[model samples]
Target: MRIIVYGTLRRKQGNSHWMTNGQWLGDHLIDGYELFSLGHYPGVVEGTGQVYCEVYRIDASTLGELDALRSKGGEYKRQLLQTPYGSAWLYVYQRSVAGRQRIESGDWLKRDAVSE
Candidate 1:
């Protein structure tokens, strides 16, 4: 299976260590969703805007590890989304983003750059 990571789990970001054994598929854009800042990490909520993501092919065990890292169904919920690469599971924010900053460019690192 494959998963789409849009936040801290992408490449060189913090917590990316969890994805060390997975195969990198490439960058992908998830449509009809938005990214928001939640301090250290970013969240993807169903809305309007392209969400930049990285695809990784992983096994059941790797997925399980990621689920644990993401808090599975608590702070984030897993959802299957269609991207240019294919269908992949994404961790969507389960809480309200009421006061958080929205990442208009859909790129977490780009948003971080603007903040800096």
Candidate 2:
């Protein structure tokens, strides 16, 4: 299974421990979306902007683990979208991003520049 990660789950991001045993495919640019900083992690929405993401090839077991984490909290909802790497799963913020800081660069690492 292909998973597109834009925030903490990315290679060196904070919560990467949840994605063990996955192979790093490569970096990808997911279109029609924007990234926002929600304090600790990032939130992506279906809108405008090029969201930089890392694609990973994860097995069924890993996918289940990811699904549990993504949905365990009400903050996010998992969804699939077509990327250059093929079909991939990504998490979208379920709450409002009104006051959240926007990651204009669309890069999760760069989000620290303006995040709280």
Best by lDDT: 1
Query: Compared with the true structure, what per-residue lDDT tens digits does model 1 show for residues 28-106?
Result: 9888999999998899999989998999988999999888978755998899877666788999999999999999889
Q: Against the unseen true structure, what C-alpha lDDT does each candidate score?
A: 0.89, 0.86
After TM-score superposition, the amount by which residue 49's alpha carbon in candidate 1 deviates from its true location, in angstroms, is: 0.7
Q: List the residue pairs that clash in candidate 1.
A: none
Superposed by TM-score, candidate 2 places the C-alpha of residue 66 at a distance from the truth, in angstroms, of 1.4
Per-residue lDDT tens digits for candidate 2, residues 1-116, read 89999999988678888677888888999889899988888889878899999998889998888778877768788798887778988888888899988899999888757544
In TM-score terms, candidate 1 sits at 0.92
The weakest ten consecutive residues by lDDT in model 2 span 107-116
